[model samples]
Structure formats: structure tokens, C-alpha cells
Target: MATAFKQIEDEAIEMARSVAYSMPIEDIDMTDSARFVDNTHWAFFERLRKEAPVHYCANGRFGPFWSVTRYKDIMAVDTNHAVFSSEAHLGGITAKDQEDDFILPMFIAMDQPKHDVQRKAVSPIVAPANLAVLEVLIRERAQKIFDNLPINEPFDWVDRVSIELTTQMLATLFDFPWEDRRKLTYWSDVTTIDVSAPDAKMTRDEQRAILIECLTYFTGLWNARVNAAPAGDLISMMAHNPSMRDMQPMEYLGNLLLLIVGGNDTTRNSITGGLLFLNENPGEYQKLRDNPALIESMVPEIVRYQTPLAHMRRTALQDTILGGQHIKKGDRVVMWYVSGNRDETEIENADAFIIDRARPRQHLSFGFGIHRCVGNRLAEMQLKIVWEEILKRWPMIEVIEPPVRVKSAFVKGYERMMVRIPG
Candidate 1:
């Protein structure tokens, strides 16, 4: 019986690997890992870190692209913004040509002069000093969200909780009116990674129509806020800035949309991912519960483990050598944050979950260098506060079912993470 069971399991594993090989992404759906990862993605990344750290991925969509999977290599490429530029507008951050005339350029999707000028305006809002002002309110919001969590009953964390809190917080940050805040989150979803989702079939004209509608709707807010003084919100900062003062009405709205979407989707996904990771590693969950003081250290561990944004793409401006490999100019480069966070060299027991792992913040979820996530502080604060509140309310939250991942290669996220919290 044991031999037969073992044979059956081996065959099942082999079949899963075969299925993984047949698709472009394995387990992209949160519930399915086979959609994005098989033995191959891991083996390839591990081998590349050792043999060809700056190797080319011929299977990618945006032409053949180079991949930087190791911690050091990603740092090298990310920090050297001059060579590995983020100015690829045609196909946002992922190494895919899916963006069909998407015009909303994130601060992360542009190169300097433009990137630097724009990043400076709201950078202050997310700075460590300024973030403290928002911490109390964030904590309050978190407490409220967790207090309502359904205990001992299966619930979709991504939809019922994570997205709700995240989008609401984003709406708060933008000072958007409560009645229309859902619209802000809706447009944000369409703006960010809609090209790769089920919604991608919208006609080109329809896409343009949505873009125009988004701009037109937000332009009213922009114009309204232009006359008002700075009120400690993102909209005010963008509208009244000296640099942005004479900017085209739509240009400012585009950036605001970027901040809302970028800040909302990524962190929300991670919150769900974090819970799922804890669910999978129950021993680690116990470790966290045993030491409430370790939450700070665990935040980085969770970020590294979950990797909110799986990867970010950069374009090589000129032919150059990286990781002992030669690369041509304008070659697409992928910084696999998920793989890099798992690099054994930098992370001791990289595969294991260590709550108090020293220097856990070294993970690359926020990328690095000039184009690192502008809202890093804010993300950390929100995640920490939310988890703290979650533990406070229900010390026992468990994954009842595997997550249902977004069917997106880009913005890789958990769409439905069925979990049970103690009643």
C-alpha cells in the first residue's frame, strides 16, 4: 500500500511539473502554484544565480529579456538606473508587451529628470517623519478592520478585507470623497494591470474611452484642488506644486492615479499573501504568536516571503556586461524580487521562515536605488499595524483553503484567500 501510494504521488508530481512547463506562468492564480512555478523556474533561477547571474530569458514576452535573480545582481542593476532604465512606456514594468496604449506612467516607470522631479513632490508625505502623523489613524483603521473579521468561518481575505482596507486607506490618502472612493479604486485597477487580466478584451476604443473618462473625472478634482491650499493630502501636493503648477491637467491626474493604484494593489496583495504564508507555515505562525514583540522583524520576513510584486523589468540602455554575461542595448532585464529574496547566500536558511531573521528588510520588494518604491515607509507601516491589530483581535487565523491567485502574470496577487479566524 505504501509503495502504491508513493508511486501515485510521484506520478501526480510529475504531471504537475508537465503542466507547469506547458504554461507561461505557474500558479499565477493564488490558488495554483503550477501556473507560474514548477521545478524549472526555481532550478533556472538557482542556476542563473550561480552560472549566469545576468542571463537572458528567451521565453519572455517583451522580446528576449535578461534576468537578475540574485540579491547582489538585482541590487547592481536596480541601483545603476542610468544603465538599467525604467523608461519603458510601451510595456510597463513586467517583461510583457501587454500594455496596448496604456498612458498612465508611474513614477517607477520613468527615468530621471522626469522621475526625479515628480518623486520629490510627494516623497515628503511618505517620509519617516511625516508618516508618524498618519500612524495613529492607520492603526485605528486597522483595529476596526480586524475587529470585524469573521472567526471560525471561511472568508476571502483579499476581497472581504485586504482590498477593502487598502483601497479605503488610499482613498483617505488622496482625500477622495467616501461616496466616490470605490470609483478611485476601480479606475486604479483598470489603470494598473488590467491589460493582462480577464478585462483585457475591452476594445482599443473602449480602452481609450476609459482613459479619457478617468482623466476627465479626475481633472475636475485636480481643478477643484488647484484653487484650494495644501490640505495634507496627495491631491493637494500634486495640484499646487510649483513644478506641477503649470503642468497639464491630465499629467497631474495620471501621476495621482499611479500613486493610488501602485500603493493600493501591491500592499493589499501582500497582506493576503502574508496571511497565507503564515497559514502554510503553521509552525512559523506559532513562532510569531509566541513572540508578539517579533512583529517588526517578521514584517520583512513576510515581505520577503510573499514578495508583493513578483518582479520588475528594466531596459538596458546600451550593450554591457552584467553577471559575466554580455547584453545588447535596449535589452529587457527582469529583477526577480521573489527569487532574489530566496537567495541562499544572502538569506540564511532562505527557504525557511525565521521570524527574527536579522536584516530582514534587505529583501527587494521595494526594488532598489533611484526607482525603489516611493511609498516603502507607508507600506511597512500599514502592514505592521494591520498584523498587529489582527493578532490582537484573533490570535488564531488559519488558511482553510489555498488562495485563489489573480490570473495575472503582472501584479501577481491573491484574489481569493479563504481563511478562518477564531470566533
Candidate 2:
């Protein structure tokens, strides 16, 4: 099975090279998930940023769309919410078009007054005071996880550390049952999994069933919270806030997915990605060891380097010109955060990972404008705390094998990575 998978990956890489290198600049398609799965999409984006920053693909898995690759252009598209709508009824925020029946109306996918109202309802989860409280808990959890590791024995760092830490954090935010915290991670995976991927164990129907299970479970919690006094937990906050309390059942499910994916994928993948990056760039790791304070800057650098969530889709609300191209009303526009993070013009030495660079947080990892990740600071906090705890123990965590990356362009992350630490 391993040998067969390797052959498939090799063939995919070869095919990606053919499409990315041999195709004309105008004809190139950046929406192919295979290119992302094989990690060959970087070259394509590099070419697009150089030749056509606002390239358009006539046909793609998600149909016709414009690829905004350069740093400035991506920012322009991301910040122009008036011209580009994220409304679920239009297309939501993925490359695939959101069908009406499958539409999930979360705040991130809404516009104007409605978006602000819904967003404000749950904003307290990452508020300054709340974060101060979460810090102590996060540190303690990190220390415990590190203390329990089987020293010198290879284990899946992604499963044991990344997922575990993030799952615990998510449970805290939701005030979920501590023992059943892993369910949060499972539902997150089901919410974002690409069933067409070769390694995806569940069918589309099965995936939807699991998501339904998640919605049902959370609904019970919502019912309990809605009747109780206001609490600091996310579910409770939503339940008590007037702006969110009257949300439709579908809206409730949508917001649940947003919080789950936001809370789970961003920090968890970055934790795993940072470890792999440190192994690849040993000098940066050594620098980090020499000056532990570098962890402060390194957290954002890791987020920029990994780019956990790749692209956010928006539908052109009105006919407008962007980057010297005429965009018709209702055209699909995709801002590839993964590509913009590597734009050399805005980010110096963009392809390399530097731990203590000036303006470390200037990248598009968390995006810009109103739709920027609400949990960005919290994600940074978790990464910082985990690294602080990690450095106090082992000198290094060594990757024993190549990581199995998730086969999707949407969620840029690791499925498994084997690592060992000093005994």
C-alpha cells in the first residue's frame, strides 16, 4: 500500500509539472487540488506572480475563476468586501461554488450589518481579558502533554501533540466535556475533508453524516446554555448574546463549523508544520535555541510559512476592474493566501523561513480586512506557549519520516508526521 501510494504521488508530481510548466500563462489552472496535494503548486504560483498576477482560469474543478497571486493584489481583493461578496448564498468562501441547499450562513460568509452583528456575538472568546485567563490554562496543558511523551520513541507528533493540544483548547472554548475533546478534532476533519482524495477513508455521505452528528451534539449544548445565565464560553456567549440567540438552525450549524475549523485547523497544523520546518531549517532551530526570545517572532513566521488555510473565495458583487482586469458581476475571485505569503516583493526572502525577521507578522497567513481570522491572536498564543514549554525540555524533536500531508488545497496541513525526542 505504501509503495502504491508513492507511485501515485510520483505520477501526480510529474503530471503537475507538465501542467504547470508546459501550459501557457493564460491557460494555466491553479485550482487543481492535485498540484497542492503533491506540493507542486508553488512553482505554478511563482510563475503566475511573475507573468500574470491576475490570471484567470477558463475551466477548473470549481469552474471559471480568477487567481489573485501577488501579495498586493491579494490584499486588494481581500479588503474590497463591497465588490467581492463572501455571502453563502453567493459562493461562501471556498473554491467550490456553494449550492443553495448546502449553504452554511456563518458570519464570515455574510456582509455588512448582519456580519458585524453575528461576529460581535462571539468576539469575547479572544478578547484581551479572556485570553489572559486562557494563557495560564494553555501553558499547563502544554507542559502536561510534553511531560507524557515517550522519549526517544518515534510517534505521530501530529496526533499526540498538535491535535491533542488544539483539541483541548477547543474544548475549553466550547466548555465541552473534557474526556470527549477528541471528538472536536474528528468533526473538524469531517467538516473539511475532501472525500475524493485517495487516502480519505469516508465517503461523501459518511462525511455529511458525521457533520450531522456534530451539529446534533452541539445543539444539545446550545439548548442548555440558552436557558442558563450568561457565561464566558463560546457556546454560552452565542446563546446569551441577542445578536446570535435568534440564529436559524442552519446558521447555528454554520457558526459551529466556523468555530470548529478556526479553532482546530489553524493552530494544530501550524504546531505540526513548525516542527517539520525546524527540522528542515536546522540553522533557524539553532538560532531559536540560542535566543529563546525569538519564539515571539517565530510564531508568526511559522504561520506565514505553513499557510494553514490556502485560499478564500469571493464572488464579484459588481463589475469592477481589479489589477488591470475587468471583473464582471458574479465572477469567482480567489485570493490564494498560500501564494501571497511567498510574494518576494512584499516579503523579503519569502520562500525561506527566518525566525527573527523584522515585520514578522506582515504576511497574509491570517488574511486582512474584516474577515481576518478572529482567533489569530489566540492561535499565536498557543504556538508561543507550546514552543516555550517544548524548549524547556528536549534539545530537538527529530522528524523520523516524511509527513503525510492532507490531500486538499483548502486546508494546507499534515495528516501524520513521525518524530522522536531525546530520551
Q: Model 1 over residues 1-423: C-alpha lDDT tens digits?
A: 223433543465566555444544321222123334322244445555666666665644335677777898888988998888776464556666435444456566778898888889878788676688789888887777777777678888887778888887888788877778777667766654444333454655665677678778777877799898777788788777776667664465567667876788888887887776676566778888888888898887877877777788888788888877898887788788877988999888887767788788878888889887888778888889988887777777766655566654446676676777666
Worst 10 residues of 2 by lDDT: 1-10
Alpha carbon deviation, residue 39, candidate 1 (Å): 11
Q: What are the RMSDs of all candidates, in order?
A: 4.7, 3.1
TM-score of 1: 0.87
Quote the lDDT for 362 in model 2.
90
lDDT of each: 0.71, 0.88
Estimate candidate 2's alpha-carbon lDDT, on a 0 to 1 scale.
0.88
